[model samples]
Target: MYEDHARIPPPPDGGYNLNALKPGNIRHYDYWPEPPGPQTFGNTQVIFSDHEKHMVARIRQADAVFGCMAWLTNYAILDALAGLEAVQIVVQKEDFLRPDGPGWRKTKLLRAYKALDKNLMRFNIPWDVGSCDQCGDPSIEGVRCMGVHNSGRKSASPRMHHKFLVFCHLADGYPEPYAVWTGSFNATWNGTRCRENSMYIESEPIASAYAQEYGTVAALSEPLDWQYAWVAPEWRIGS
Candidate 1:
């Protein structure tokens, strides 16, 4: 991890919006207080805190969820995923990216990983971790990378940098591909601070394609090691 990086970086511009990609009622997460109005990037609508809310709301409605996230440390989104009842879910994430640090502490990332494991265990859900070849962290084992095969090779691209979520059913009980959420947004605090855009596609074909892709990636990935003997519990959520 880049231990010298700023904890809260300056916000960037020109990102995607969820509403602009598909036509549907605007989704919002009520758990957190409402944020400011929508932001726009040229002709496209841009959502910041609202985008996070939209994602939480979508996760609330899903009967099953499958996704790939390049980074994850957002508590609200994690809670939403953990709270799902009777829903089958599998999320693939990159553990070696953007880890929190104050000179090699990495306390935030360790806590996030532990929280995710706790949540998954509570609900009996499944999850996977990507290869560490890109990170070159000898401590972590690279079972199988998601996007690229044989990522262990020095010439190969080692990161599975995809950010997407697919919901198979809504509250109305659709069979599958109820919607697909994809964007540049990461589920970390820093990700929200930056200018980002996301789109929700409600097409069966498109969602189906993503769902299939998720399956293939998941097949190549490895589940979290519950023992986690190599990692220490750094901190607790909301600490």
Candidate 2:
């Protein structure tokens, strides 16, 4: 949708600004600029009838956002998530983190968050570990297998796959969600590469519910605390 991280469409912008007005059929803005406490602004004839003129206000009101994906491999997405305020992040990834990994498996989440602002903190959860012998143990898989385990220590799941984003449009000083984005787009290059679609839901109850789910997953993302050692037990004592 956007040409860059700024979320700006390509120049010579044609067609309507999809998000100029919040989705979910929300025709008016609950929070207004004047002193009448939004009554004057919420007037059906004044706001709804002429909403196209209020595009600036709608864009400024956006703050809260959400994204869920089967596998997040996009750097731009990662940087944006890390910079968002008061965000709880949850994502499943297909690749493993290795210091010596190739291009595909080199997306280090912790590093991504830390690189943003040094103080920026985000709960980056990985796919939940599957029930198997290798749940926590760090034994080598095979000659070609990489040692680094997936986040949440979960084995990769090829079946359960879904991608979505929820954004809470909060006005200055207001700490609540007013908009949300969700869909099957992986929030990565997959969004543009594959046949995917997304919908923007602009309702507090709906947005809040999805946001809560992200919080729940963040809390339950405790991975196994096992370390990986090299293959072939080298049992050399104090020799």
Candidate 3:
């Protein structure tokens, strides 16, 4: 649990903006409100580094977790999450690299992917790379470009536009139990930089639903279809 670490650490540069969405509050950067000195609201904490930082810290405190992100560009964040008991991450297909062109763009993208491959192989974590030609239903699984080719309505730029985490919280008295955390944030800097919201809920029904969805997405993944520049040895393409 988070009993040892300081859950309420110091705030980020701009601090927490409790009301960033009120009226035109989030519109202009210069007009953003400053923390009227150190602030606290009950036990609620705000991490200013973007949603991924909060997620990494939270996952570190959990017994286990399942994660799904549309974009996977942050190696530092992924490296932290690799220490978790369990992890499942689904990202865009290798085509995401095409947009980066060559040189440093491609090199950096491959480096980040190699980090993912290392975590999956070394820790035996469940992670896949996927992307579709077009977008699909946000409510359903396999919206990412790697979505199982929908023989029905194939298109380009199918995006996995969801960001969610399911975990079992560890406690002193009760058994580690299931909980869900989801939001409009990716595991990237854009998640924290852009205005986004995340929801944390713990319920058997909700957990079960998301867990099943995670499985569905994994099943739809074609690991051998698209290969990263630096792929795990165990993931060598199958004939």
Candidate 4:
């Protein structure tokens, strides 16, 4: 409904002035000075809102955030997530792929988090390694395939496909989620351009339930004691 990342309309004449607000100037995590409602383009009604800017704005309001997406390659969202005070991101270990010779390799997502931050630590349980015996283990080379029966490692390959974000505010000196964003919208370039639906639910009960689900996923992210080598070599204090 909105413009793609590559096709975002130009900013105002002087460009975005973070210090001062001006008409038609779009600043990160701020209300649009003049929002353009949906426009009728021939037979289609298109929304011109800046989805990335809106998402970043919501993220900036949270003291803590949690997200899980099947596919995530949006750099803007990644930067915003990293800036959060406290955050946990879960994603399919098999999805962050880039070409590696004839095979595929880990994307910058892994290195970006491990070397600089500790928030995006959890790995979704891999359910994509279907029929490894026939097609071979799809896990990137050098990375251990938890599902493969090599020496003594045997892990479950269950589905973990979820696309949602939970935003929490501090309550009683502890973080408590007040809202959740969930839908089929993945945090990827193609995902933003595709036709998808999302929900921004603001309910104490629902948010808390999502928070609990996030906790469960984070706790049981990888197979017991079998960490995804791409995330970190070994667990640390907070991880």
Residue-level lDDT tens digits of model 2 in 191-239: 4444344445557777667666544443333222223422212111111
Worst window of 10 by summed lDDT in candidate 4: 140-149
Q: Model 1 segments beyond 4 Å from truth? A: 1-49, 86-157, 170-175, 226-239
Report every candidate's CA lDDT: 0.51, 0.38, 0.48, 0.50
Tens-place lDDT digits, model 3, residues 75-182? 667666556544456664555444345688667755554444322221122222222212322121212223422234457545545577667653542223366667
Minimum summed lDDT over a 10-residue window in model 3 is located at: 136-145
Q: Please, what is the TM-score per model?
A: 0.51, 0.44, 0.54, 0.53
Better of 1 and 2 by lDDT: 1
**Stretches > 4 Å off in candidate 4:** 1-50, 95-107, 115-158, 171-173, 223-239
Top-TM-score structure, candidate number:
3
Off by over 4 Å in 2: 1-61, 64-67, 93-95, 98-113, 116-162, 169-175, 223-239
Candidate 4 CA-lDDT value: 0.50
List model 4 lDDT by residue over 65-160, tens digit each: 765666656768777777765566656545233223232234464544443243221332111221122232222211111121223333654445
Error of 4 at 143 (Å): 16
RMSD of each: 14.2, 14.9, 12.7, 13.7
Candidate 1 clashing pairs?
15-197, 16-197, 16-198
* TM-score (C-alpha, index-matched) for candidate 2: 0.44
